[model samples]
Target chain A: MRALSRETTALTLLLAPVTLFLAIFFLIPLGIMAVYSLLEPGLYGGVEWSFYHWNYGRILGWADGFIEEFDIVYLQVLGRSMGLAALTVISTLLICFPVAFWISRLPAKQKNFFIFLITLPFFTSMIVRLYAWVLILRDSGFANQLLEWLGLISEPLDLMFTGTAVIIGMVYIFIPFMFLPIYSSIEKLDMSLVQASQDLGASPFTTFRRIVLPSVMPGVIAGCILVFIPSLGNFVVPDLLGGARVVMIGNLVEQQFLYARNWPFGAALSMVIIAVMMLLMAVYLFRVVKADSNR
Target chain B: MNRSLGKTLLTGYGWLFFLFLYAPVALIVIYSFNANPINVMTWKGFTWDWYVGLFGGATTVSESSLYVDSTDQLLDALLTSLKVAFSATVIATVMGTCAALAMARYRFRFKGFYQALLFVPMVMPDIVLGIALLIFFVGAGISLGSTSIVIGHCTFLTSYVFIVVSARLAGMNPLVEAASADLGANEWVTFRRITLPLILPGVIGGALLSFIISMDDLVITYFISGVDSTTLPVYILSMIRRGIKPEINAIATLMLLFSIAIAAAGIYFKSRNTAQ
Candidate 1:
């Protein structure tokens, strides 16, 4: 009995600080945000204590017309954010998948070196990386300079502030997130299965479709989720690269808070992002649990 | 012949892949030394004027050429970043290490739930967390500043430390701890002598990682950092928004080196622990 009590005491001591800290800081803040999403916006910069559903109604196209007219623009921004995030995921997957395969086939020493090179950017300042894109995509930037020096065109391309620039920036910064998972999955792929499929007279494409795709699907899904979530709520890339042209949902949320001072509306926009994140997580969890049970 | 051709193609593609990953970074590093103050993209004679100017040293460059309004503001932001990262790292490391020990050693009810709860903060969107913290701080009457930033960082940083420490704890041999207990050492003594020493590398690595992350964190800090308490990244962001300058290139290059050095150290410790 005394030993059991001592064990309990030790467990309590170990867990108490994190639990309390997370409760006060993490859970409470999130809970307050959820509450604020439903609260009324004040005239100036703060929120009123009164209940208001129109903050969300503004985004969902059910605003009370008198005070707040529903704006399809918010919904369009949300859709654009998701669309861009999806494009980023697809582009990163396409770019990393073959590279991951190539790396997986390399000698172990070279493989580690390459992996280190890939992950090095992840450790660097995100702003610095984005700034690099700003330099490359600006009108008087390296891309234009290089093209002009090549005698390809006299005119500079309108690259910066385009959706293409935003996607490129997102893909550049998020390569490691997509690469690591796909590389690990490719490393675990069974060469014997591929050989067997090929031996059965399957074409290379057929064998890959039959054997490799299924094996790497988990990693692809995981990489997509990792890339997509950050991309979905990414304000910095769109703000820096997209400028005033390609506004994403994250920018809308930022404007609401910083410029508009509509805290409740900003909170509402954030909740939309949270909703999408939770849904995706739920699907991923369900798939994982199912996979585990099948195994 | 087809297989050999495919192999060559893949090899070439791999090199291109790496080039894509690294070219932008290389461009920034090379251009940092370029003397073109008007257009940073154009190649000019190499000079360290930008780097020299960053440290408040006199440069041949005219005052109109320099974009930064004040070096004092830049230094103040750096100081704020260092302060926030240090305090956040210390608090997060302790809490995370403790939680990791409890979770790894104890088989308790709701263990899965607790683990999931910890992960939510990590996977939650940074914007959501930033706004949530902002609302919470303002509503709770807690002033937003370094204190709030530290608190905000610890919320997620503890989870990172927890993961790193837990991985270390997982790899450890339980028999040594049992042996210490059997040799009449109490739980506390066994933990101090056996577990703590074993996990020291992981703890240090976790601390370094959290420190780097805290220093680099912008989105959350942007929302929560009140007037006059901006960190380095937030300050640099404002600079970039105002205009591109040669000095930013110098600052970025320095930041890149600083982060790479700390990250390399952290990875060294991690790899050493795993190798053991």
Candidate 2:
């Protein structure tokens, strides 16, 4: 009984601050948002508790009040967001793989220098880094100037306010994130297995296909999830580089709060996005947990 | 021969990727020295005027040369940003370290739930968290501005600090603390002498990272920041909204170099400690 009391005391003391912090900030706030999402916006953008409406339903449905014509705008933005995220993941993988391989292959004495160089860029603020992209992609930027000097184009191309520029910004921001995971995974991998496979008459390509890929698949997946999720919900990158032409779910949420001044509708939209993210997290956790158990 | 060719190609592409990553930063730093702002493409001549101009009359300038002229009030915003980020890092570090220690040392019920809950702030979209906080503040009739921004930053920054310190804590052997306790040291003494010294690197590293994230943040800052409370990034955005400026390139270059220098020192110390 004394031991039980001691354990309870320890547990209570240990958990008190964390619980209080989360309750006041994270949980209560989220709960308020949930309730607010269901409430109707008042005449002056204040909450009107009694006049509840499913105006949020209209966000994902057509103006004609028909459920079947479900708002195509949300679906279109979702599709575009997913596509951009997919491209970013592929590009990150392609770039990070060779870099990771090279770093892993380097002698331990020189490896720190290589890692330092890669991480140097990461120490800078991300906004500063993205702003550099603006300078690079501008009509008078270096990219156009180089092309013009090389006679590749007679005039500067409009690269600044395009979907392509958004992708460029995303890839630039996420490359380090992808690289760190893959690099760590590659570093942890035992190299002797590959050598043994070669000794067994396995070709280099076959060895890489069968062994190297599987060994680092977790890193790839982690990298993909990290890059993909952030980019999908990204508002700043799309807004700044995509020139207000491209809109992601994040921008939609921002508009709901600022421009539209519809709190409940914004809350509903945020809730939907959160639900989607939670679903993705559940699926990922299931796979990871299952894989760990198998291992 | 084919294998060699493949290796060469791979290595070439790797270099190309490096160029892609570094080129923009390099260009920005170079252009900060430009004598003229009208022709952004060419180097009319090298000048130290921008650097001199940045520090000399930052307060009196009609507008920042970096962004639109409308952002003349951006210096005050930058100062507010520094103040908020520094305070957030300190508060979060202390809170995070305590939480990390408690989680690491004591095994208890709902441990998994607590951990998952703690990590939610890190992964949830900024928009969700930001708007939620805004709603909560408004519901409570609290005014939105610097206080809200600091609270919002601390919410996520604390979790990040906790994660970093917890990773370090897990790697640490408990025997040292046990030994200190056996030597008649009290709990606080044991912690201060044994655990704190060992985890200081992780604490500093996490604090540095939090500082960077807080400085760079936009999404949450945008939601909660008032007209009077513009962060540097928000200021830059408003500047960009009006139009581009040559001074922005200068600002970017300076911020980049400052961070790099700090990171280099941090990494050097960390690697040196590990070597010992």
Top model number, lDDT: 1
TM-score of 1: 0.98
lDDT of 1 by residue, B151-259 (tens): 9999999999999999999989999999999999999899999999999999998999899889999999999999989999999999999999999999999999999
- Candidate 2 chain B lDDT trough over 10 residues, lowest sum: B60-69
What tens-digit string does per-residue lDDT give for candidate 2 at A169-274? 9999888889988999898788899999999999889999888888887787778777877787888888888867878777888888898897887887788778
Reference-based lDDT, each prediction: 0.93, 0.80
| TM-score for the A chain of candidate 1 | 0.98
How many backbone overlaps does candidate 2 show?
Answer: 3
Scoring model 1 with DockQ, what do you get? Answer: 0.85
Which candidate wins on DockQ?
Answer: 1
List where candidate 1 sits over 4 angstroms from the true fold.
none
> Listing every candidate in turn, what is its Cα RMSD in Å to the true structure after a full C-alpha superposition?
1.2, 2.7
Candidate 1 lDDT score at position B68: 75
Interface RMSD of each: 0.8, 1.7
What TM-score does prediction 2 earn?
A: 0.93
